[model samples]
Target: MAATLDQVRVPRARAGRPRTRPDRVLADKGYPSKANRAWLRTRGIAATIPERDDQIAHRVRRRRRT
Candidate 1:
């Protein structure tokens, strides 16, 4: 999916290099795993995805344990 996103080229109005990357990406909780978030971060793309419910619960449980 990232590769496919990189292949996209949006033309510029003033005759410069077309945009090869997007400013941000919107995704649902299903796509917000640590690996996916890290991958997007490495590419300098901002992602607006909510964490999974299980992940949230795990964090809460871990905090309580600590």
Candidate 2:
């Protein structure tokens, strides 16, 4: 099976053309991960993914000062 989209725009094809990238991407619960955030930062893409419950608990346990 394959997904035949109406149009596809990739960042790789346009080194010469101006890159008008999106400001941010919003992913739901299934995509809340540290690596995902880091990757988005590398590309200057803001993410709107909420932290998972386990991640929130760990952060709260270790980062009490904040």
Q: Write the per-residue lDDT of candidate 2 for residues 1-66, one digit (tens) a residue.
A: 002111323365546753444467777787787777787777687889887898889888999876
Error of 2 at 32 (Å): 1.7
Clashing pairs in 2: none
Off by over 4 Å in 1: 11-17
Best by lDDT: 1
Best by TM-score: 1
Compute the lDDT of residue 32 as modeled in candidate 2: 82
Please report how far candidate 2 places residue 37 from its true position, in Å. Answer: 0.7
Write one digit per residue (lDDT tens) for candidate 1, span 1-66: 567677888677797999987778888777887888898899899999998889899999999984
In order, the Cα lDDT scores of the candidates are 0.83, 0.65
TM-score of 1: 0.76
